[model samples]
Target: MRLSDISIKNPVFAWMLMFGLMIFGLISFSRMGVSQMPDVDFPTVTVSVSLDGAAPEVMETQVVDPIESSLMTVEGIESIKSSSKTGSASITVEFDLDRNIDLAVQDVQAKISGIQRMLPDDVDPPSISKTNPDDQPILWLALTYDKEDPEFLMRYARDYLKDRFTTVEGVGDIFLGGYTDPVMRVHVRPKDLLRYNISVNDVVDAIRNEHSELPGGYIQTDKKTFNVRTMGEAKTEEEFRNIVISRRAGVTVADPTNMVKIRQVADASMGLDKIERMSRFNGKTALGLGIRKQRGTNAVSVARAVKEQITVIQKTLPPGMNLQVNFDSTKFIEQSVGELNHHLILAVIFTSLVCWMFLGSWSATFNVLLSIPTSLLGAFIGLYFLGYTLNTFTLLGLTLAIGIVVDDAIMVLENIFRYNENGRGRIESAILGAREISFAAMAATAAVIAIFLPVAFMKGIIGKFFMQFGVTISIAVFLSLVESLTITPMRCAGFVHHGERKTKLGKGFEALMENTRIGYDRWLRVSLQHPWKVLIGSLVFVAVSFISIKFLNKEMSPAQDQSIFMARLIMPVGTSLQYTDQQTKKRKRGSCPVRKSNRCMQPWGALVAVFLIPT
Candidate 1:
């Protein structure tokens, strides 16, 4: 049978089948994770290593150089850069865009480990950290309290907060900074070391030996084992002072005649000391919390997890202490996504209403609505496959698409109705109407998709962010056109029936369209007869539009909706006393009066030479 014969025979069954397809399409969309922007990962990796007794130059030569040089031989490694600071070395390796990070890291590790014995003894093994900046902290918080001490905050964060939310499925890690415990410091004077003929190494050994408590060898007297130990260790500074260094019997190293005593050379003490200052928030001493999301994880989901954990821990915080969020990507993502979603729904609803009004049949409306869900689902499926996202570009394209997708449906349905009015049977009209314009719809969709191809080819950061959107919408619109030509025609053919009747509203709509065409005919006739007037009027309109663009203040999208709006006026535009009086009257109602509070702003205040901020 011909394609037309199939559509004419069973259009409603075809409609039902398409509905089932839409349900499957919904399943495809559900598998997608939500994010604010296009999902992509840069190809980069970092090696972190610690070096003891090394300055920056020494660290660069001893640790950073060896690692970077070794990794340089790894295949597909693009660029290798290293930073050597006080006691640590970080070497970042960037790879080509197509390189797999996991494989690259494995290759680097295998090569470095094979040459392990060659590295210095004091250099700890280098750790390959995943280099995606998307996995970096998406949220930052400042925790502050008056009564809580640094030790208390430090203990609370470590014991209760950091691990709880960080363990959430998509959360990478949570870091707490600013507050640290005072560490135990053992400072020994250099004079004491010389006085006792003891070196710094000896003092270090003494401290290490005195602080530890360990079990010694067991004794086997009477078949009952007993453990022995050397007990005179320092529990406090006083105890360390009395820790005997040399015996009165002249127990000497290398058989020396010098006798040693505990007080002969050095003063040693155990006390707590602060080593490094930490970062503070807003000029106030407070602990900062940073939350990182796992790679390929949902930003919004991890943020929600952090909040839930914070809620549970809020009860345990010291009085007046709280975690205040300073930065949250989720806020902007949720807002922007929510607005786009709202617009999508409104567009769909408005389009559906318009379609129903024009068709005046419930069955026709239902069939048109079927394409809405299917188009969106198919778009998401394409996105999932291609790694695109529902970001600004994709959404804007979808918004632009609200009118295009339904054009085929409207045209096909209208033609079908037109055939029905010609006294042909329902099945015959369905077949003829669908066959007539399927090619035209396909061509228009091709044009739409073609417009975005150049957008996909755009370069740099801006291009990277918007390319996913461009490709997603491009593919979606093309698929929609195909579906409209193929699936839509098949369904419309089968659903049309012998007994179907046109509503009065549809007939009226047809009459209005007829009247509009007649009006256009008259306007064209008048314009063609007066070419000079037409040319002059068009020129005037163009000039006015140019002037508007030059003078008016415009923004790309709508600002937040509110009951009030404000305008700031500077040394600008011509006005009259009547306009100024009107503006003053308006300000008296709802606007706050602007105050110039700086004494320097006064003309007679000696005009002090001060640069508050360099111009």
Candidate 2:
């Protein structure tokens, strides 16, 4: 028998196929991991150089110009934008979207290595950064303690807290920002630098050479092949101080005293000099912690894990030091998705009521209701396979398509009812309905899928989030079409009521349909006689379309503003605690940061009160 004939012959098998699709969908969805967004990478990178004391002009001449010139020959480069600031140079390298970002980074490394010797030896190795939404911090925490030196707090944040946070599954990068790591800094004196006549290069070479680590060549003499190695990792301040500088050329052939200790020559340059205190939380001394999540892990899950870990770690903190929660993206996702899910459930119930009222028979209504879950389950299965989510957009798309998805079931049932009312057999009515409207149902499904074609073609950020919604709904509507043609008819074989005298519920619907028909006929008759008026109305609508296009503001994605807020901090070279506290306390209500220093922190910017802070 043909598929439709087989479907008409067996309702149980049809339902089985539907559940099979559902099971497959659930499996696929489980396999797909959660992510902030899909795995589509942009072809862009940022390179930053820390020339701490150099002016913009000096960085431009010494750092930026050489790097840009060397990297100019990279493949697939679309454009280059560079900036030089008070203490650094930043060059943003943009490439074609189709290019591989990893390969581009590799190319940049090669380019830099080729010109390394030509650039200022004082400059640090340029760091490469990839541009991705995933790079955005998933969470920010502020740590504060009572009158403690910032170094101690930073050490706790790093040596104590950092390793634990990094070990959490799904965490990407943990950064200890807004403070120093508390290290002993050996300040090099200017007088010693001049006396030794040490160029910064000499100091750089001496330190690197003395601190060099080497793997040894093993010696084997039969009894045992023992390993041999020499190691060095800055044992003490004195070790760093006593490192030897090269012998100077003797003014006299036999003169023997020109060697210098690295400490003597290095004393001229100001080094990390006892970890300068940096302020976090708006000029109040604090240590800051940031967590970045790994891709493909659910944001909701990762955020919860981070919170739990923080709670566990809080018990270990010293008295007075506390952790302040600053950012949590998962909270927003959970709340928004929960609301969307509630609305979707309501939509499903309302749709089922519509089907039951129109059919006015328990058995017939059951077929249509079954079609709804079969369609929905099938759609989600498709979503799982496609690596999509039960997100706001996808749920909204499914909700919108609900009316369309049921249209097939309605058409099939309408035909079955019509055939049965003519005194046809139940078996004959089922087969006839399937045969009669199958082509029309398929055409309608095709049209719905066509509507989403443009959405799939959308490119860049906005497109990435939306295309899945469109595809999920389109697939669902199509599957419902298949059910309407095959399964609905088979289920109809055992049940289609036929009688001239109408049941009480059917009679009410019949009367309503008559009223709707009469009202629509009235409008149809007037429009048929006045084509010119209809044409003029079309012209007016077309004109309004142009006006809307010109007046509307545009954005790359839908604006999702939240009542949730955040705060940023700035500390001038020497902002005091009492002053910072006063400034935080004096914030004007509902404000944000402004250029004026006298203006207190914004109302949204919490003063980071010491007592209530959470670890």
Candidate 3:
């Protein structure tokens, strides 16, 4: 059967089909994930190894060189870069964009395992990880306190709050910054060690041996056997200090009739780990918790979840402590998405009003306007199935598609109205009008598709960003074409005016259009009479536009108002972590109002690798 014949004769079936599409579209849209940007897999992997007390040069030769050599043989490797720092080495391998990341990671793991025997015995096992851009921190939280020391706060967060944040849905990792645990630092002077006839190595061995748990052989009895467990770990700093190093029986003039202990040879005291890193907020000694979301998860949702959990976490915090969120990545996403939605609604309303004013009948306007929602709703289904997220680019495409989608519907409806006014029956005019414009409408839609479909085939990050946009617009246009041929004619056959039914509003609009037509006719006649003058005027206009192009400023993308700001501190090489923290504190204090009485953090030896200062 003919397309229009089927739609007009069986209007109920057509309506039912449309209703099904609407239902599916709504369901798909509701179920789709929301994020700040589309999910992109960065093609990079990292291998890091740590060897204590090794110089940078030693790290390069023993750790980085071995790993880089092995990774070079992996398939699809694009490039390799390595960095050797004090006692540590990091090697990053970049692979082809189209390569399977899991397979690449597996290949790296295999390569590392083969070179295990070649690596230094004291070096820790090499770690292989795939780096994702999306894994960057989505939220920065600060836990500031006045009365408590920073070391206490750091331990509190590590012991109590770290696991709490981890339990939140979509939270991948939580990094604690600018805080370190109080580790015992034993200062053994050379005179004390010599007097006791003990070496620093002997003291180290004693401390290491003092803290351990080992399983002993099972004790067998007549009835049952019990497993033997020995716990020798120190529970307090005094207990650790009292650990014995060596016993002397007054056999020599330098040795006394006493056991040389850790407390005698080395003064054991609680102190922070040697500060390697420090974070500060607004000039206050601060501890930061950076929250990252898991891959493929919604960043906005995950960030929201973290914020809500923070509220709960605060209730349990110490009285003087406060947790404040300084940076949230989703604020821009929410604002941009909301603004786009507002513009989308406004466009639909204005476009519908334009259709009504031009058609001079509410029913004819409805016939054309129905295509907008139908096309957009159907496009959501396509987006969901194609794994496209609702991002700024995709929404922009939908907004631009609004004009294109309505064109075919208007064309079909106008043709049907023209035939109906020319003494044709409503049903016959609807079917015949739609049939007459079917090929034209198809060709026009194809032309629009042609303009954007090529973008989908382009390569690299730019291409990936626009691929969803092009596909989104193309799908909406195609759906609109189908809607115009089917639903537009079916509705027009029933609701469109079949005779010259005129109202005051209709008569006024008709008179206005008639005047416009006359004015255009006169202008056309004048142009035809003075073709040379018209040609010169057109040439002048073209020249002006061409000249204006050079003055326009261009940018790849507009800057977004993210409601967050960052401060970066570039310190000199070999600077102590303590010095970095001190500098950071001074800068932080100047940026925000801080309570002087509050020692936001205690001086601890904990070292931070990279710190984030949020304002």
Candidate 4:
């Protein structure tokens, strides 16, 4: 039997099929991952090596060159880019889109391992890591304290906060921003070192040699053998300070314990490792905790879980310390998706109203409107099966689909209503009406799909982004065509009333339609009679359109509101922490930096602009 016949006779099957699609679509939506963009495999790996006190030239020649040369032989390598900064070398290896990033990283690690012995003894082993778009921080949290020292904040975050955040689901890693591991600082006065006749190397040797512990070998006995442990590990600043440096031999009647200690020659204290990086929020000393989500996870769900956990964690924080969310990625995605959904709903309502006004029948409008949800709901099934996420691109496709999906249903129902108005029976009119436009509907759907199919299969990054959009629109359109052929006719046969009941709105609509038809016919006759004048006017309109194209500014993509802002302060050369703090506090909008000598005179200006800081 024909599809429409089956749909009308076995309407139960059609209803059940539509219901099944709705159920599966809802389930798929709930299970689908939410992200800012499609999870495209970046296929990039970075190898970084640090050699302290080495110049950029030395790093390039010694560290970066060898790694790049070795990695050039790896499979699927597209390009290799390297940069040599002061005392460090960074090499990024990009692979073809089809390359497995995990295997590529393994190959890099193996290459590094083979070349480790060739590198300098002081240079650290290369750090190999696979980079993904998911590596972008999902959240930026700033932890600030009013009266606590940096050491205290660092210790607290390292000991308590870092581990807790790592345990949160979907969190791949928690990087403590502006954090420094502790180190013992030895401040040696030049005068003191000269007086003691000791050099920096001598002091280093004293600490390194005396502060270590080694196994003292087992002492054997007849009854039992005991393990002997040496106990020279320095556990305190005072202990480190007391380490012996040198002893002077003098021929005199004096006490034998006359060796010079490290503290006597040089001051010893605990401090953070040489300050390489610092974090601040509005000029105030702050620690940022960047939480990154795992690949293929729902960013909205993960961010919500993190926020909820942070609420529970706040009660346990020490007084005067506060944790605030600086940036949340989901806020933007949720807002964009919500706005699109709102527009989608509005489009459906407006489209329904237009259908009612034009068709002048509530049943016809209802039948036309039914296709919107059925087709969109069915698109979710395709997305779920294709491993696509509910991201901005996919949502955009759905938004555009809102305008196209209803056309098929509108065509089918309008034809059916017209046939019924001609005195045909309900079932006969529904079936014949749908059958007449079946080819037209199919052709229209295929033409639209053909236009977007090329975009869906585009090559490179742009293609990856637009693929979901194209696929989503095509799926919705195709399903609407199906619904138009089957469900639309079946519904029309059952629900469409035999005769139109007269109403004031209906009369007004008929009057408007009559006026529109008259104006169109008059315009067509005028155009046919004065063909030369119509051609001239058309040429002028076309010329203006082409001329307008030059004035229109274009960009690759429009900027989306991410619901976050950032500001950067550039300090002058040799600017002291105190001077920087004093200048920063001069601005009414900025907070104070963590420093004691905060009183100084310097004018500073911060241009309010967005800057994407390199990670």
320-382: candidate 3 lDDT, tens digit per residue: 888888667777777788888999999999999888878777888777778888899999999
**Candidate 1 TM-score, C-alpha based:** 0.66
lDDT of 1 by residue, 41-90 (tens): 55778888887657889888877777777788899987988888766888
Model 1 scores worst on lDDT over the 10 consecutive residues at 599-608
Shift of residue 175 alpha carbon in model 3, Å: 2.7
Q: Give the poorly placed runs of model 3, Cα more than 4 Å off.
A: 179-182, 215-225, 246-259, 498-556, 581-590, 593-615
Candidate 4 per-residue C-alpha lDDT over 111-167 given as tens digits, one digit per residue, 9 for 90 to 100:
999988888899987788876676788888888888858888888899999898888
* TM-score of decoy 3: 0.84
TM-score, every prediction = 0.66, 0.81, 0.84, 0.82
lDDT of model 2 at position 78: 91
Per-model lDDT: 0.65, 0.71, 0.80, 0.80
Maximum-lDDT candidate: 4
Please give the RMSD of candidate 4 to the true structure.
5.9
